[model samples]
Each structure stands twice: as structure tokens, then as C-alpha cells.
Target chain A: MDRPVSEAQTKADLGETVLFKGAALKLDCGAALEDIEIAFRTYGQLNAEKTNAILICHALTMDQHAASENPLSGKPGWWIDLIGAGKIIDTDRYFVICSNVIGGCAGSTGPQSLKPDGSGPYGTDFPVLTIADMVRAQGLLIDHFGIDSLFCVLGGSMGGMQALEWAATHPERVFSAVPIAASTRHSSQNIAFHEVGRQAIIADPHFQGGRYYDGDERPRKGLGVARMAAHITYLSETTLQQKFGRNLQDREAVSYGFDADFQIESYLRHQGMTFVERFDANSYLYITRAMDYFDLAADHGGNLAAAFEGTKTRFCVMSFTSDWLFPTSESVQTVRALNAAGANVSFVEIESDKGHDAFLLDEPEMHATLDGFLKSAAQARGLNATKEAKDD
Target chain B: MIDPKASAHGNLASSRIDLQLIANRVEPGTKVLDIGCGNGALLDLLVSDRQVDARGLELSQKGVNACVTRGLSVVQGNADTDLSYYPDNGFDTVILSQTLQATQKPLEVLSEMARIGERLIVSIPNFGHWRVRLDLLLKGRMPITGSLAASWYETANIHLCTLRDFTDLVDQIGLQVESCITLSNGRAREISGKPSARHNLLAQQGVFVLSRG
Candidate 1:
């Protein structure tokens, strides 16, 4: 049997881990991890000037396989549509890098990574992380490539938070930043939802206080339940109604019991079960905690504008109309701060019914806006435009 | 004098009399905010020609998206309500090109423009123009002229004003007119002194450059 050509090409693009021996990553929580490692995948060639590099930060559940086949799932990458040859991100024109963030399970320095002393996986012992910490880890990886400044740093949700952090903390090194479906800080409601997920994970007997590494039975049920609860937040009520709508699953009538009777329930169960197979329970806890700890304004004396004061990085912030998790109002706050700081910023609230997940879905308005913004940024950065521009 | 380079722009031309008049008044390399910048035609001109850091606020989603497609910084917001988000003296010039009359709160919007911008450039269709006056008088009903083409009930220009009424509002808001030009048939000429009844009656539109008193 012959394999697909794209799969063969993507596997070639997939990169392994680059260990930074003796390099210390100082955390926001007063802890430092030395000899950290970053697993990243790259697409396209870096121009001679090294001026056409774009760093794509991944969301909470996304890994480094942004525009390739995931080695684990044997599935297409999350952003395969937006970041390929002649795509909106256009790998043919620029170098695109996506890395598994620190505290993530994907071959990076995380809860699953063994301790330096070789005792076991870090597990629950991983120091509490922040969005800034993840960005700091990424900065080391960029340094290894000898790239002084990224042409653009962009992402959605947690990835968006990192993009903003890169712009705020390392302003000189970022030429542009795009934060989609993100907020300056995680709201209380978001924290509450995360708490519910964490509680569900902790309640599981197999979790063994986050040290399920040695056991054959990892906390699959707990992680699955956590994913199920969190998945509901990613979509809007409208999308749930439209997609499933109290419809029965493989039957004409309700089961009248705790079985997956509704199509929505079955769908959620499948989502949770599949997610558990790929993601670690402890990594989820650390990553969500990091997101909750993110507050760009709090660190700047409660002045969000102070984060980008006198910065030159251009910004484009986007929000979905139906994304109540990170609502349009949050994007408005960010835009207002960018305005107050006298930064060059563009904002677009796209009409999306898919909720926060809209950024990951097929949104023509979002794609068009991003394409135009990137093209303009490329021109400003002096990156040569491709001969054949994708007609978006 | 009309800029020979102005013809290079795709949609922007000397034919957009109000926009050209507004664009000409803006200094190069200044921060500009264009309220109701439909499709960002004027902003595109200001950014390329003047090298100004231009931003826009448009009410229509279609208009905002179009502006973004051009890589111009524009936000979808209403002039009547969204002005408070901007900081004081945020822009060197804030333009309201032919959009003043369409605003729900013309006075508040003007005041907010003055608050946020060091200078405010406003243009409005002159309701006191001879064509509008003649149509209303002769027809004994609401006037419909070239500039005010929409029917009275259908028009978004709820706060229609003449050059004199606009000047009065500017004065009432404690804004001094730095320069004033009356436009008629794609032509613009500076008023020699304070806008009089003659200017109001003859001009189809008026563009005023104002500063806080």
C-alpha cells in the first residue's frame, strides 16, 4: 500500500527536540529550570536576511505540528489549512516555526519530562509556570536559530497570550504581533471552569496525586472528563444546538439512564476520550494554571498601556462575536490599551458562531484579515512577496 | 492645486471633493484618526502620500473589513458612542468627512473629537445651500439635492446643518476655526473671513479645520 505524498512531506518537516544544556529558564514563580529542551517543527526556508521568520505560538491543546501531520494521531495538523504553501501563512514565502510550549506534553520540557536527577517524570513537581515563562523558554529556542527578531509572532487563545507577552516583554525582538480570541488576563469565570477540570482530574484514583507516570493505567477517565468539560467552553451554545440539538445518538428515543443518549453527549464523550489518548493529565493542569496566571496589566501597575509603552511592534487583535469565553469586550479592552499606549494596532471582531474555537475553524473573514495584515507586514519588513499570491 | 500624484490612487480621486479637501489640510507625518472612514479611501491616501500614522473608526462592518484588507488600521465603532475609548490628544488631526450629519449626537461627537485630537477636520453637506433651499421652497417639502440625495425619512443625515449652523456649533463647543473652505461641484475655495450667509447659500458643503479654544 502506498502512503499519501503530503504525509511523507510533513514527516520530513517535523523536527525533534533541541536540548539546551545548562541554559536556565527563570520562572515567574521564583523557580528556575536548567538544561531545558524545546521540541519544534519548522516549515519553509529562512531567507538570507533572516527577516522573513514567523513564530506561530500554539493554543493550550495544540502542539508543534501546526502545518504538518501529527506523528501521534496520524492526522493533519491543526492549522494545516492556514499555514502551507500558497496558504494564508504561506510557507512558500516565509519560515514558520511552531513549538510545543514549556509545561506541555509534546516532547518539550514539561511534567512528563524526566527530572535532571533521573528520579522520574516531573509530574506534579513541575514548578508553577506563567505565560511569560513559556515565552522565555521560546526565546532561548529563537536564540539558538541566531534570529535577532521575529517578523511576526501570532497565535489564538493561550497562544495569543504568549504573542502578547512576546510583544510586551521583548518588544525590540518582535516586529508584529497578532493575538486572536485572547484577553489581557484570564477572567474569574475562566478560572472557575479550569478549577472544575482540575478537580475532576484530582478526584480520579488513578491520578495518584499527578504521579501516574509509572502506572500502566494513566488517569484516562479523569483527563477525558476534564477534556469534556473544557470542550464545552470552546464552543458556543448556538453551535451545540446547531450541531446536535438534543438529538438522539444511534437511537430514536432517550436511554433514560447515564448512557450517551444525546448526540451532543456522544460527541463530547468522543472528544474527551480521544483527547486523553494524546494529552497528559498533569500537563493540562500546569498549562491551564499558567493561562490563569497571565495578567499583562497587573504587572504594569494596573495600566495595560504600560506593557507596550514606547514599543514599535505593530499589532492586530481579533475576537469572535460568539466567543464568550474570551469575549469581544476583552479584545476591546486590549485595543483600547493599545490606543492609549499610542501603538500601531488593528482590531477586527469577526462574525463567528463557532465561539472561541472559531479561530481554529474555517473563518473566511478571519483568514482574509490575517492574509492582508501579514502581506502588509511582510512588505514593511522587506520580505519579497511570492510570485503567486494566494487569492484569498 | 490638485496633486498630480493623487490620480495614482485606485479609488481616491479629486472627484471626492470633501475627502481631497480634508486630505490636503492634513500635515505629513502626523497621527490621524478618520471617523466614519468608509472603505478607508482618504486614509489610504493620507498614509501613502503624507506618511501619516492613520487610524480609522467606521460603523459599518463591511467598511471596516475593507479597510483592514487594505492593511489600514480601522476599528468597527460608532462615532456617537465609541469616542470615549480614545485618550486626550491621541491624534494630531481627527477627521469627520461628510459624516458629522449622520451621527446620532453631533455635538457630543464633535466635542469628543476635540478632546481626543489636537485638531478636528469636519465636513458637512450644507442644508442652507441654494439648491436645497430652492427645492424645499418650491416643492413645499423636504429638499432632495445632489449632496442630500436620500429621502428625508430614509437618510442617515438626521443632524443636517448649514455652514452657519455648523460654525455656531463649533463656537458653542469652544472650538476655533483654524481654516474654513466652502466646496461646490468638486471645487473648494477658502472663506476670506467668518462664514457669512453668502457662503452658506452658495456652497454645497463646508470643510472646517477646528482647534479647541
Candidate 2:
């Protein structure tokens, strides 16, 4: 059963939060949650024909403020470089929609939210949600807009997983998909990394078994360590060497003690310190666990191609050369499966010394690739831009 | 001519000599794969002209980007490594446009291409052209002409061969040539029914249409 979007509650930096009152969401894990709230932001205006809507899914630790300044950090959104008035995603041309995932913090219903029983934060008790559940929830948001289909769905890393899921589960709804720096399933190595990070948060003394949100104390040290570890996976050894080799941390010589001596150490310390101020520890555990459980092919009888058999949605899977976290081989595997399914697909492996984080960086080649793909997809979908050009 | 507004070189149709020759022989409404498709000029032409369902595999990232911007379905992959993944008889016509020699294993690549394609179209620069031979005799050095434009040290044509040599390789691979069009620049002329010595000295380039006998 489903409901409609209630009166929107807008935030200062993040966009409006619409409550789906008495609306039950059936999750992939056999649990149903009623009264769900989703925080989302929109850029550009939906055309009268309603054919120009594009959804930009966010990665782990990213929120719905995709191109705007975040309320917490006051810094420009993660994709500020690739999205704007005349940028690659081109707000001048397409109406872009971005939303905080259900397990995310910024204005969304997450483990940080108070329990319905007025007990406390849901914490570890927040029923585990998978990538499909998140897509199911986002589908409701698209429904609320009265939009029948999306022009394109795109993202990187975990966001890419959501894009892939959106296309596989709702092939009729997505015209095109661009999954970058992502994989069909989370490898065991990735699961290990998440396990390590989860251990960091769970082992923290102040965690009190995931109930750290309302306490006077918080799991700052543990969450910071977790961030510091996960942040390393986001970078390549080449990038770390290039950015901050063996140089000391703004000092002449090494401390030769427990303190951060190398510049790399100092950089990671800063990344971890800044991250915890914005994200919640419990949310981190939930999202990472969801990612670990994400194996789209396994759900469909171990045939990735079967999941996309005869799919009409066009695809362009992009990857970076140095991204060990989600390597080019994985992206190529996706292309091969799409080929087996006879799906319309293209792939590009960008040459970069940067690692998985390259997707979030300013890449001119990526911009042009996306611009061309979306433009062509828009043409095929009979969007206004293509219609006007045809008239001209 | 396809796509009067062409993405390559501002031409109504592709002006490349090799691509022009290859595009003509392809039937309309067939599935095609262009290995080392460069900027996808030929694939784009096939898509717009013959209504061919075109796909491409390019080794250069920039080339792949250019192809994507033109809205061509091209992947960044090496012909040597990536061909093993494609299913057998997946395409009607598989084209190796002046890229067969640069592959690490030419015969192995051909075997794979032959397996995956019902019809194989190969266009090659003949190393045994009279000009290349005359240059070797007179200058006592590697030739650098319009056909073989790059210097030997810098050229990607590592396994350069004459038309006669390729015919022998094709025979050894047990495939029969359906037709052979020998070219000087872009203008094509019919070659003899069987491989002849004249084809080696006269033709600057050759395009062969072949299938399993």
C-alpha cells in the first residue's frame, strides 16, 4: 500500500522533507515501515511535458544537496564541479532530482531519528535496509511528482549501485543509466573494509551498543578512526604519494612518536576529523552493511545478464584506471553482462592517477561523455530540448 | 551519405579512404562491430546510413570519449584482450579497419574475430606496394609515404604485410574470401580470382570480404 506526499517541511540548506503519512514501505528484508520521510532537493523546473527529469543518486556519506552548500559543512556540494547552470549535467537543460537515502542522516529518517515509542534513537534497532529498499523509497518520491519516467539515472560508488538497481528493478522507468566507479556485487575485500569500520564504531566506549545519538557523549574517536581507514580506500597509492609523500606535517622533522609526523597521516587526520562533525556513526554502520549485502546478480538467480535481459535502457559504465576499490575490470564485467543480455551499452575507462575518488573530481572527459549520452538519450525520449532542435 | 551533419571532419559522409571502402560493402540492418574504431567515424556512418546496429571497441581513452560524444556505442578496450568476452556469432559483420597488424597476436585475433562474426571485413595497408619497395631499394631505409605515413620507429603497424602474405594467412586459417577490392588511395578496382603477384606491387591498400568456407 502507498500514500501521497504531505506538506513539505523545508530545511535551511537541504531541500524539503516530505512525509508519507501512514504510508507503509515494504523492504527487501521482509520488514515494513510506516510513516516514512524522505529529504530531497530539485534543480531546474520540470517541463510541461515532464520528460526532462534526471535523478542523481548520492554515494555513501553524501546527501541530497548535490550542487548546493551543505548546512552542516557550509561547503559546496560534492558534485559542484560537474553540475550547475551550464555544467555537464546542465541545470539549464534538465530538471535534476537528488535525495538522501533512507539510511542517510541529513534530514532523512535514519538511525539518528527518535523512536516512535519516544524511547530513544533507533540506533542498531533501525531495521536493516538494502539498496533495493532505498530504490523502492525513492520510487515513491518520483511518484509524488506525477512523473512517469526519468530521463536518466546516474551516480558513482554506492550511488552507482543505486543507479544500477534503479535500472534493473524499474527498467521501464529509466531511459538511461551511467554507473561509475561501482560493481555488481561488493567483493569480500570491500566487505572486510566495512567490517573494520563497523568494528571501530561498535568498539568505541561511548557507543553503548549504537545508542550514542542522544547521549551527552558520542563515539567521536571511533568514528574518526573508521573514517580515516575508509578514506584510505577512496585514494590510490599513487595519489597519496603525489599529494603528500614522505614530507613531514607542516614541520621540519619527524616527531618520532605517536603524533602524526608524515603529511599523509596529517591529511587523513583532517579528513576523519571533518567527517565526523557531519555524519552519524550509526548511519555509517547501516549504509555500509547495506552495501555489503548488495549483490544484484545473486538476487536474480546468479545471472547478471538475466537481470537486464531485453532491457531498453541505454547504459554507459565509467571507471578510473587507478580505482582499486571498484576497478575497471568490474565495470568491464558489467559491460560484458549487458552485452550478453543484448542491452544497449557503452563503457569508458578514464585514465587517472586518482583512485575511486576520481568520480567526484573535475574530469573534463567525464563531463563531455555524460553530456553526449544525456543529449542523445533526451533525443530518443522525445524531451523538449530535442523537440525544439528538431523543429529548428 | 549519412548524417549530413557529420561529427568527423565536417563532412556529410566519412572521407577516410579505408572507411569509405568498408562502409559500402556492409548491408543495411545488420549488426556490426568495429575494432579499433578510432573516433567511431565509420561506425557513426554505418549507424546513420546503412541503419546498422553499430558497436565499437577502441584502445585510446580520448578516442572513446570522441566516439561517445558523437553518441556512438563504443567501449575502451584493447582488441587483443577484450575480444575473448564476446559471444560466438554475436555480430553479422566484424570489421578490423587497419588495426589487425597492431594486435599482439594477429592470427589469434583473426581466429577470435572469425569465431564471433558471420562475415569479417578487413582493410589493410599493403607493405609490398611498388612505392614501399622502390623506397627501400633507393633510400635503403624504411618507407614513409601517404599510405604508411608514420616513421617506422613510431608507427603502430608492427606486423605490416603485403596483400599476398595476408591471403596466404587467410587460407591457412581456412576461410574463403568472398571478394577482394584492391585500392590505390580511395578508388577501388577488382583483383584477380586468385592471389597474384601483381596485387602485391600495384595495390596500396586492400579490403577483403570473407566467411568460413
Candidate 3:
């Protein structure tokens, strides 16, 4: 029922794609998929003891280029500021592994991948995946490296869901975990937002029942609209007020038309337009659906503590003050469960005006908190400071 | 004497008069939770010296952040509100160091601590010490001593208690005092008999080890 990694194909930007030729990945929905491919990138060297490997789970719309430049956007990695030589994650001292999650289009087996019958892309037919399923696929990639346990499993938002899933399902393999700006389950409001985005994509004229990949025209308008709507949830009213504040876009005054006359409107339009170039519409639908289905406590007899009973993995849960998408109350609920389970856990609510996307931005307080946490965790795990770190 | 190796944690047991006393009563390798653990100095000491599993609940975000930086499992929570979340008898030792006076409801906190911990280590500054009594009697105002240095206007010690008052509450809550120690002018002395006026007047601070009766 399981197989090791095969060097069947290689991909650029997202790194190498390992084909599991005969392995079947069983999903939470009682479905199974075979011939799966996982794309991942590795930074720094795995220590000889192999105890210094750190797995960085990517958020939605992010690829495996965590500390490198992305080919598509020609921009630095999403976490480039925190994960590099002598940085907070400290690539010089730890081996970093970032993989594109299943149902993600960045060189990963997703809706864009071909169907088993070789008819065409799976698209909507791609087996509905869960956060746990994404983590399960990542586990194979971890096994391929012959590492017994990872030093840390870290992420934010949807990626935080994967981190929580990794710890809950494979507690023994995770030495430490940091789930930032996340919750145990998706809220009804979040699910409603996702439904709106899905409806937008499905209603696009070029969608053609999720078979638009072969057509000359893709569902750009629909996917763009979906991205535009989702992008609004990532920011706070304060951020919008301070950054744009009713400012007109390249005009003396408001045009009063449907055009993007305001700066905020133009900004959202740009976010949407750029998103469609690299992301697949069906893939977005699959990823969001997986997140909506994520409820860590549901499978554990409705007790979140039961999921982490007697777990030895250390946890550091964080939230932002302005993050309404995944509020600080959710992190408090998680901390309470960890307390009931008598687990080693820490929780911090960072002061930031940015919303759910604060984890992606450069925050000095967040940086300092993570630096100290990772340093102490590394010391506890007996990971030595690299030569460069020692000098610094 | 201060251990040079412990200086890395900034004075360690000697940093505070009562931290070492609380740390001494905790059994090695036992699960411990320190309520209102400011900056986690005592929790850090217990962790490194006794190798105990240490957790903390800090009221302020700054304190919680500091505790996490030191690798302690700490959450931002209040003593009166957040104690209900922990299960009963979850920790071997629950520590409340110099925080009972500042709590909104001291009795509820004590009862919760008793329920959540098999043994409780509590330290409180005795308000009946001769220095405090004399200062109040002579100055005809609130006392301010080396221990109770904060003025009444700015002090967080709203529910300050004398040694006898604390013991009376302990008995009322059905908690048995396993051992009690008093610190007077940087000296620690164990009080073996029942709580008395003589001990209350002499001791600047009292540290008690209690268990559910």
C-alpha cells in the first residue's frame, strides 16, 4: 500500500517533483488516489544526525520557494525575511524543507494534473482533499529524506492547519510546532466567503464545467474575481484606511463609474489579475474546500485535547490583534485544550495593525518572538549553533 | 552563595527572596504550573535546576512573551478567569508566588489551585509584620516597607492579607498546611506550630506548602 520516492520527473521554480509510482494516498473522505507526485525544495544541509530538519508548511497561494526567488512573480520568497542564513528560522543552522501541498498547483498533484484515464486534467474531478491528506502526502516526502523526526513544523493560516494536522496525526515525528494566525476549525463566516469565491469561479463563462484548461481562453475573469474577494479578508479596515484612505487612483477626483477609480479598488484589481497568471481556478476551489472541512476536534470525539493526549511535541501558538479572519480567541481555545491535555504549549497575541496576513509581513515583535522560541527549542533539541551563528 | 552558572538567568534563586523558597519545596521531575509568572524567572530556575516540566500563566502580554522566549510554556491569562480551563490535579505543584494579593478573587483562585494541583506552593507578603504595623501606626497612613514598597495608590495589592488571615482562609477552604516558612529581613525560618501573632509580627513574608485536606 506504500512505496518510496521515485526520481521520475523534475520541475523548475517549485523544485523537484517526486513520483510515488504505486503508492496510494488514502484521504479523509474515504477516497484514495494512486500515482501521486509531490514537489518540494530543500534549503541548507541536513545534519549528519539528521535531527535538524525543519519543515515549513506553505500557506494558500504560496509555493515551495520559501527562501528563494519565485520564477513567476520574479519576487523574493514569501518568508524570505525570516528564513535564510542567520535569520529567525536560520537556514545556516537548520535544514529547511518546504513542499507544495496536495491540491496546490505549484508542481504538485492537483486538479491541473492529468486524470488516471489520461483523458485530460482532473480539474473538478480531483479527489476532494483534506488538510490531513495534504499532510499525509508531505509525510512521504519527509520519509524520502530518511529523517526520523523533524526539528520543527511551522506555518500560518491554511499552512497552520497543516501544521496542526501534522502534530495531531504524527506527534512523535514533530519535535516542535508553531501555528500562527490559525484555528482548530474554519468558521462559518470563512466558509461563506469561500463559497462566494467558488461560486464566482464556477459561474465564469469560460469555465465550461471545469474543462476550460484545454480551451484557448481560461477562466481568468472568474479566478481574478475570486482572488479579489479573498484578498479583502486578508487585510483589516485600519490597514486600508491608512494605506489608501479614499485616495483617487491616477485622477484629480473620483470618476464615479464602475472603473477602478479609487486606489483601494486598483490595488485589489492588481492582486486579482496577478493571481490568475500562476494559480489554477480548480486548484483554488480544492484547497479552500479542504480548509473548510478541517476540524481537528471533530475526529477526536469532539475534544481537541483528546487529539493531543500525552503528546510530547512542544507548541507555540500565535495570533495577531487585528486578525479577524482567525482571531486571537481561537488561539486561546487551542491553548486551553493543550492545558487540559497537560502538553507543553505557549501562546502569544502579537500587537499588529495588519490582519490575518500579518504573519507574511515583516513584524519586529513577531520576528523577535520566533527567534527566541526557535533558539530555545533548538537548544532543547540539542541542535548546535552553526559556525556562522556562533560568530554572530 | 550564588552559583556562577546560574547567573546566566540573572541571579537565579537569589534574585527574589521567596523564589528559592518556592523552588526548594517543588519535587524534581514533577509537573509544575506557575500562575502569574512574571518574566518566568522562577519557572526557569525550577526547569533548569530540578528538571521539572514547567508551565506558566502570565497576566500581561509582555510577561507571556518573555516566558516563551525563555522556552517556558506560558499563556496570557488571568488568575481569576483562566484557571477554570485546566483540568483537576493536572500538575504536581501549582505555584502562586506573590500574586494572591493582586487577584480580583483570591479565594476562587486558591480553590482552583487546590483543585488543579496535588500540592500548592503559595508565597505572600505578610501585612502584619512589625515594620508595616509600626509604619501605619506612626505615619497614620498605609505602610511602605522593603517588601511592601508600593504606595497604596499605585499598588496592585488590593487584597493584602496578614499571616493569620491567610491561614484562616486556608483552613476555611479545607486545605491542610503541610509546611510553612517565614522570611524576615533576608532570613528564612521554618514555623512548625500553628499560625500565631508573634510569627505574624516577626515575619515580613510567609511561604506555605498546602494540600487538599
Best by DockQ: 3
TM-score, candidate number 2: 0.89
Instruction: For residues A1-392, write the lDDT of model 3, one tens digit per residue.
Output: 45654655676656777888777889888888878898888888899999999999998899898988887778888999999888888888999999999999988899999977789899788889999999999998898888889999999999888888988999999999999999889999999999999999999999888888888888889899999999999998899999999999999987778999999999999999999998999999999999999999997989999988989999999999999999999999988998888888899999999999999999887887788788888988999876444555
Which residue pairs clash in candidate 1?
A: none
Name the best candidate (by TM-score): 3
Give the distance in Å from residue A223's predicted Cα in candidate 3 to where it truly belongs: 1.5
Q: What is the lDDT of residue A64 in candidate 3?
A: 90
TM-score, one value per model:
0.93, 0.89, 0.95
Write the residue-wise lDDT of candidate 1 on B1-213 in tens digits. Answer: 012111112223435666777888999999999988877899988988798999988877777777888899888778898888788888999998878887789999999999999999887779999988888888898987766666777776788888999989888999999888998887789975358889989998788999885
Provide backbone clash counts, one per model: 0, 0, 0
Off by over 4 Å in 2: A1-13, A116-119, A250-252, A384-392, B1-15, B131-145, B149-155, B168-176, B190-197
For candidate 3, the C-alpha RMSD (Å) to the true structure equals: 3.7
Model 2 residue B166 lDDT score: 93
Ranking by TM-score: 3, 1, 2
The residue ranges of model 1 lying beyond 4 angstroms of the native Cα positions read: A1-14, A387-392, B1-15
Residue lDDT tens for model 3, B44-90: 88988899989999887877887887678888888999999898889
Query: Which ten contiguous residues of candidate 3 chain A have the minimum total lDDT?
Result: A1-10
Global Cα RMSD, each model: 6.1, 4.4, 3.7
What's the lDDT for residue A287 in model 2? 95
Error of 3 at B70 (Å): 2.3
